[model samples]
Target: MSKLPGNAGVTVLGDKSVEFYRDPVSFYGQRMDRHRGRVFLSRILNRPTVFVCSVRGARELLCEKSNIFQKDPTDLMTNMYGDTIVTTNGEEASLLRLSFSSLFTGNSLESTKGYVTRICEQHLKDLSSRGQCSYSVYKSLGTQLVLGLFLNVNPDEQPELYQEISCLCTQHWHGLISAPVNVKVPMWSSGFSTALEAREKLMAIIKDKLQNDKHGLVGTLGSLPLPDSSSASQHLLLFISALIPKALASLLTSFTLALSGNQQVETRRKAQTDADYLGFVLLEVQRLWPPFIGGRRIASQDCTIAGFHVPKDYGAVYISHAVHRDPEVFEDPDSFRPERWGERNAGQQHLLCSFGNGPRSCIGVKLTDAFLKEACMYLLQHYDWCVDPSTQALQYKWLPVSRPANSPTISFSRLDENPPGHSGS
Candidate 1:
């Protein structure tokens, strides 16, 4: 611990255990300045950890795919999603990604088009009915779309399934982020117990679906020729976490923010069907608001990152907030400009680490890309968006993933009604 680059004994933000609990990005951003943008040390919930901000350093730590940087037991992915692709290392993670590879074929995606279209229409219709949308609406849309796409639930059962999912996601978040420090002492927590109960209930639904030969990711998992028997366990881990919820939040936030300003998207309002433009907008949103901010890796043995020694078993944090805002890579590091992502900036697109990058990039990247593109096309071809300036621009709440801190008031009216302030494609 003493060998790390910054002053080992000092606390950042001038507090013994500085409170960045609600705002880790700011904490790391300040530390990045203090350490000259490479690396620094801080304690998350009072646990000693290393914070690495440089793009090259993050890439080295995340992309290496070696035993030297492994998943720590404390990582939320490992804690909440044991041994899944996000939480595993090297060959095992590689193989898990490979097994899911078949799920992304052109033919497979094409088959999903009609369903995706229907889900989007229904979700949009719901938004229109509500007149204004916020975090709950977005989350509900994601959960509904997920259940609608993944399962063949009867119309009567859809509400119940959504309720179950909501409970599970709520409890999962509670367990993942808000439990007590001494809660490891067993008697200190009922939250963990509640989360476990919710998990059992959710898993029961999954097991029942599997027994009845259901569809979507559950069926895809076993049929994909996974490399190990633990594939069931790994698949179970990944599904229990809210993949759709995070993506849903990202999609809504990005699209609304894109429409609220950005002349590039305005040009495409109705005249252009350039697939490239839609992709670029989504990419820009993610670059600004990555679904998950950076990630955690544990050193398996002694290893050096950008000349600083990372000792064995030490936890390393890679902050996306810092990496995404690199001035060298992005022109006006903090502005919301989608035009900056067009053809002229193609060379740096690879630098966008929204869904992560390199060998073990997000397992859901292809599925998510297909989903986002389809959603973007639906929005561009359908309704225009308007932000309620009475409401603020997107502010964040950093959980295991980033989500809107509050339900900002945003209107998504239909093309026909065309409210004066609203703009449509």
Candidate 2:
């Protein structure tokens, strides 16, 4: 039993902790039922934990003095991702971040527009030919787009390797959701082994490109401020590996919305524009279904959050899904409304934690935005897509990332008229 802070009192939750661990969203909501502005200190994962259900408490934990609250990387993420930017903090995090930031400049993103557009068009053509597609769009298209932009490869060229990387990411999530507290899981060991293999393959590809001076998309990476040549390659590979999983996870969540018939017509119409509807849809999906249960930060010293006393060294879990759907912050918390993110509410923008906030916010956000926008716009513009009515109210399994439990079978038909700004193939 872990010791509680002087200011905090522990609430012993027996099997309730198991229920919360099993499904956090539903459990959190149920625990907060009929209680307004209450902070509960409950046991989770067999550890004494503070569960902040109020919006004010969550905001203070995440935004206010967030530096004191550090991210506690899980065993699975640490083993697979290691000390890469996603799981690292302090000076090392800053240095690696600075070196990688150079790769996402306005010019770099603009330069890759052609690659993004080309991939989008190609994917649309392939899907259209299939007539009925039930493939994991994240695995098939989203992974390729992010990998191409970051590492400069056509994933299809090395389908087996790409498939392995995708499987590793998926399995990493599986281990997290299913593994018990005491077990020395095989999934963790396997995930790490697979990650190393994928890294070697990626390095080989990068080295081949560098040796042959095959300036494909990697030409854009030349401007990055790596400390040395070796570090540059290492950083590039690690960053790509870390980014690919998050990118695909987010993309799959957005695809869930599309399969639910949320924005079929709009996605098709906006596929040709500089801004993609997938961008908007991703923002919406993230708002609806965030990847993580929010981010965790350990308190540096004693603090008060929404009236609850948080002592030094305590961990704070910011529930992003709860904050994103807060009735006070959003108009209708449960409804899917993409237009809320448009120019109309530009001034009254709600502080969404999907990309996080402050200095530690997501760096690959622009690349993610670009890829999603391009993919959604292309798919929506060229094809009419919807989930087969036979399986309409499908539920998504949320862990590691959100994805549909049932086969998301969507049908597509090529449009008779070309979408605006798009030149039909």
Candidate 3:
């Protein structure tokens, strides 16, 4: 067995050192190609770690033996989420998952569709008037869209607060990347404070809407068959925290990509045929730029995987980025191909690892798809947009989420000259 440097519990094959603190996205494609079907173990300080890179290996670690392999609770997620479903395991996790499943059911999705469409349309209108904007469009658009879903607040109504909230979420996400070390940072402290303030602001909105019982998203959530007061409040907080960051990240990434694509020529008809093009794009992005690189599991007892010896209490980390981009599984794996996810192959789209597979798969997948679809449809129909080619080579930072190190600047012009519900207006 290979030994890691400095007595770190991690062991890498040959000279391939494990990089726990480094942003995995920086070498995402390369790592997948080099280490597919191999196991590389390293220690982040004193924590024992393992990185499984192949699709089959990851499946065994994440799905088949998931009970033994569990999610490690980073200080950041634990601080923000407490023992919420995203960080928990076993029966408690399942129960919490079940309690909130209704919020994302088919009927719930249908109900939110119109609201999503309206929000998307409203944001597009705002962007159209600007002609061009450079502040992280994904963060801006996603904040409003997610806030609408959570509290029914329009993007226009809370632009400043939304911006702050987006920043706070982004900061918190970065905290997760740095993990135990970041928890001690002064910046992390300030970010948490900001997040708490934002939460208060959000709760205030919810409280006000709860009092009014108005026809808003909060009103809708208020009407759900919630558990007891404590559980219900916990549910609300967890749901908001869990979703806000991801929704914002996905929306921003999608918006950035959409705006960068060929938008000068009218392509409304093409966009409609792919009603969920944004969702597809986001899915592809998740595959390409997964925020979380590894899934952890503790060995229940001595076991061997792929001829590697394991002792009881050993922890395994399934490197999802490596699995998602494995060349053997995906053709031209580095290229973005949304068409591969069309209806015909939707059933065959199991190779992606944005969401883990089997019982632990992300529960929010359906809702995410809904939000992505709506955002994509509205943007494609209403704007002619493109990325600045000079900025095309922008680097991405992998923290709380994968985002351009610099905000992707995009220009947009209204397709208002073309009528709504018509292609190429």
Q: Please give the ranking of all candidate structures by TM-score, highest first, separated by commas.
A: 1, 2, 3
**Worst ten-residue run, lDDT, model 3?**
1-10
lDDT of 3 by residue, 70-112 (tens): 6665435665555666777788777777866777776776788
For candidate 1, what is the lDDT? 0.65
- Model 2 agreement with the true structure over 195-290: per-residue lDDT tens digits: 455556666665665555446446645655655566555555555553455545455545544533433454445534535344555667777777
On TM-score, the stronger of 2 and 3 is 2
Give the CA lDDT, 0 to 100, for residue 333 in model 3: 72
Query: How well does candidate 1 match the true structure in TM-score terms?
Result: 0.85
Error of 2 at 201 (Å): 6.7
How many Å off is the CA of 180 in candidate 3? Answer: 5.9
Q: Would you list the C-alpha lDDT of every candidate in the order shown?
A: 0.65, 0.59, 0.58
Candidate 3 segments whose C-alpha is farther than 4 A from its true place: 1-19, 26-37, 133-135, 154-228, 242-247, 251-255, 258-269, 275-282, 291-294, 304-307, 339-346, 389-392, 416-425
Better of 1 and 2 by lDDT: 1
Which residue pairs in candidate 3 collide? 10-41, 10-42, 11-41, 69-297, 70-297, 138-252, 173-400, 174-400, 260-387, 418-425
